[model samples]
Target: MNVVSKIEAAAPAAAVEAPAERMRRVVAVAVEHGDAVDREGRFPAETVEALKRERLLSVAIPAEYGGEGLGTAAVADLIAQLAQACGSSAMIYAMHQIKTSSFVMHGTGSEWHRAYMRRIAAEQLLMASATTEAGIGGNLRNSICAIEVEDGRFRLTKEAIVISYGNYADAILATARRAPDAASSDQIMVVIPNDANRTIDRTVVWDTLGMRGTCSDGFHLEAVGNAAQIFPKPFSEIAAQSMLASSHIYWAATWFGIAADAFNRAQAFVKAAARKQTDGTLPPGALRLAEAAAKLQEMKGHLMAAIHRFDAAQVDAARGDDAALSSIGFAAEINALKVAASEKAGEVVRIALLVNGILGYKNGTPFSVGRHLRDTASAPVMISNDRILSNTATLLLMSRFDTSLGG
Candidate 1:
């Protein structure tokens, strides 16, 4: 089935509004304010409000928790559509879903997380993540800070390197060492609500070239909550099982959305140029447009394939296949998807810019692709393609590549 068919099939039986329809309304708001959000370097408040109104935040949560229980394919499709409207908004939405997936897939064993999922559905609360830390560099698995437990409560102070939409999030999912004396890699995921008991002090400004509206600034996050807020599983298992795959898939979808928008603008410019030409002559950029289209198609194919693999793994995992989600081949494939999508997204946007020529280079024009290009440029460096490649290389060394067509 096609992506749209899969999304429709995955929708809840009792859903009042289809996921696609709700996204259309949200996309309208995102497109309307995308420029202003980018120019001001602030959060996409209006678009987020639309999301809350549409209740798309809880679409990934299970139906048991008042959610739609949509699969990864459906969520990725929605994210890509939103990215075509606004990169920052789409990214914010993707991050929220990524964090929510963790709770839905891993936190159901605990009552606090189960109740929080219900609250997310009822209240449409936004979630942010704080996995990157100061001293650890870009290694998310290691953390210097640890959660301190006392009297059935826990407290943690993390010098987060970057927290996207941190201030606006209703709750932040942070990673830290399991105990004061535990190894740096012995980490746990904690859900810290942005309430009176928590404090966030901005330590770094988030003025960047692209995706400025994300407001991904560094902060000193100090929060206290019940011990039950922490997930029972170690951070490593959670990352291997859900977090890594979800992050790569959703993020690639977001990049594909941005690049797709650029391709659209380029196609429009080509058609407009064709209209002005005499005889049956094609525009100079027509060839380039075809090339960019191919690259975009390839990017989409990679993303869709990854989504299918992950969805299948989820099914197998549910069927009691313990290694379905954590196999060496699966991990390498997902990591490779992120690397390919990120790099190809930049290529597609850059080619689109060339197709639009000077019009696309400018900031304000009917065929301008500056925003798309800039936004896509951040994809490669978001998690640092180099870092992912290194990790994937290690994984590949231990596993043989599957060359079979149906493997």
Candidate 2:
């Protein structure tokens, strides 16, 4: 059988049991179909459709919402594995998870909450995140979108860009400036149906060195007014809710998976070539490549340990105290992992390129590592290394003091 066919065949087997396993299966199918979809610039319709049928896309909903209800660790693992195979698919999945977090934070008490979750569970109601904006970026403090309350109703309008699935999502979770007088960062989130009269300008095209399949095209919203199922709470509450229970962990997993993929591909190539070049001579290049693999493995271990700590801290928070420690710790570890993973992936790609030489550049060769290298390169930029380290240091410094923020 061909490589794609082999990947397709492995999916169902992987998904036979748990929700996470099912997500893994979904990812396998996405990867199997990735090359063709990317070639045509088409969405992974078949893979996404399969996820709907298998209930993989709805796995994050609360159990009461007719879903499997997986947690952060499981979610992260699934995204990472999918990303390792198809970064575009993984990005799409990450958008969905982010939307789900927003829903839980803001839509839980709305009249449409249960119905929306039910529909998501039963149908291929694709989800996307309309977070990033034009010049202002995704900063909550300076959002350009606004909600004007009028006679017991809310009118929402936004001008956003680069929505992960903006081209074709059944629903979009959008952030807008809340009505003035609402508390800090008071950004409001709403679920807008794709058909809601929103104008998509297809503004800035997604032309990147990696994640080419994400199709993160630009779009604009021109006074698309829905009865704004007002999230039934203050905007500050929603902001805190999202920050407390976010899907940041899952994206971290994707980065780790990309790193792992690079390491695995390079290792396989090196081992095979080593056997072929056994003219009783061990070259320094081969030795250095082996050392890099070892370092990559260490990074993998650190990532896994971080996942464990994050999960445990989440459990602890659910039982009693808040997950402030876990959140800060995970952020710190993720920063370290981002650097380690990105650097190692690049190193592995370089090694593979050097070791495979002409064969590495060949289209159909197993040693082709260019795409993986590019994909891994995005990790560092995704979550700024300086920002995370600074946050961690600030948190640690504050912990040592007994003083309050305000007198």
Candidate 3:
């Protein structure tokens, strides 16, 4: 069926206008202003401000802490919807949510952490990740800096490869060696609220092909906080349970949003073409649109399946280094989904571009898909799909799953 037919026969829209309704309104603002944000390489501050007004920044935090207390799947839906309007805004939001969820996941037994969570909920404070280091080569599991302690106070300094929207964040959640004498891989996470002597010092410029509104520039972060600010839990657990897992899920959602936008555009083009013809024939480009739609459906299924699996495992609330998740092969499967979703999202956008032909290549037109095309191009390389596949290759070699019917 064509677009109009689908809508006429469509299932009922929500009676009360669900939270996604608010997100869609935020998306409309993003779609209106996204071009300016991308062209000037400026942060989507206005779009972000609108989302904050909607209290979306705290959408995933627990209710006891004054947030919406939504689940990972729900948060993923929000980000995907946001991406349909503005890729930069969605990604920036995704990173902030991932960091805040990290704060919630592994931070325990510390009164400071509890207070901080309440403060984040109250303030709707945006969070930034200073995880990627200058020399870590994108390995979040390793960090070269160490926290130095004197009396009950601790200090840390790190050369961050990129801190997305660093200037706008109220605080940064960063990783460091567990102690001055700890190994590079033995890391601890601590929050450095934006305060005196604790601002992110920009060391490099940010100019990129797409997702430019993120303002992801290099920075040198230095800060001092009470030793109690440090999470008692290991960084490994935080990364495994919250950072990596949650980020992958949310990232895939936004990617889907971008692709969905492209697919919608393509659908409009095909619908118009059909309307112009008396026979209501399928346009030559209709097949490409079909492929894009199929890929999008596949992407959503793959992502949500893995997400619900994690939820069922209750692994997000599991304590300690979370070595059990890896032992049971959940980590490997999640990584595989990340790889597949990233690659497939890009493909969907590419097919949509093909369906739209030269119009999609143009900028600033109703049918123009340049922004969606550009943003989707960055999907696969954001976390380096090659690295993920390489890691999963080892799992494939040493482990196997039962594929028998009804087994």
Instruction: Evaluate all candidate structures by whole-model CA lDDT and list the values in order.
Output: 0.91, 0.64, 0.81
Task: Give TM per candidate.
Answer: 0.95, 0.80, 0.91
Tens digits of per-residue lDDT, candidate 1, 1-407, equal 85334434544442577889889999999989999999999999999988877779999999899788999999999999999999999999999999999998898899999999988887788999999999886798899999999999999999998999998999999999999999999999999998998999999999998999999999999989899999998999899989999999999999999999999999999999999999898988999999999999999888888888898898898887849799999999999999999999999999988988899999878778898878888988988999999998898899898898893
RMSD of each: 5.0, 6.3, 7.3
What lDDT is obtained when candidate 3 is compared to the true structure? 0.81
What tens digits encode model 2's per-residue C-alpha lDDT throughout 109-179? 67687678877765547788665677676454356666777766566656676677677788776766776
**lDDT of model 3 at residue 187?**
94
lDDT of 3 by residue, 58-116 (tens): 77777777666788889898999899888999999998888877767655467888788
Which structure among the candidates has the greatest TM-score?
Answer: 1
Model 3 deviation from the true structure expressed as Cα RMSD, one decimal place: 7.3
TM-score of 2: 0.80
> Which residue pairs in model 2 clash with each other?
none
For candidate 1, the per-residue lDDT at 355 reads 89
What does candidate 1 score on TM? 0.95
Ranking of all candidate structures by their lDDT, best first: 1, 3, 2
Score residue 6 of candidate 3 by CA lDDT: 40
TM-score preference between candidates 1 and 2, better one: 1
Q: Candidate 2 or 3, higher lDDT?
A: 3
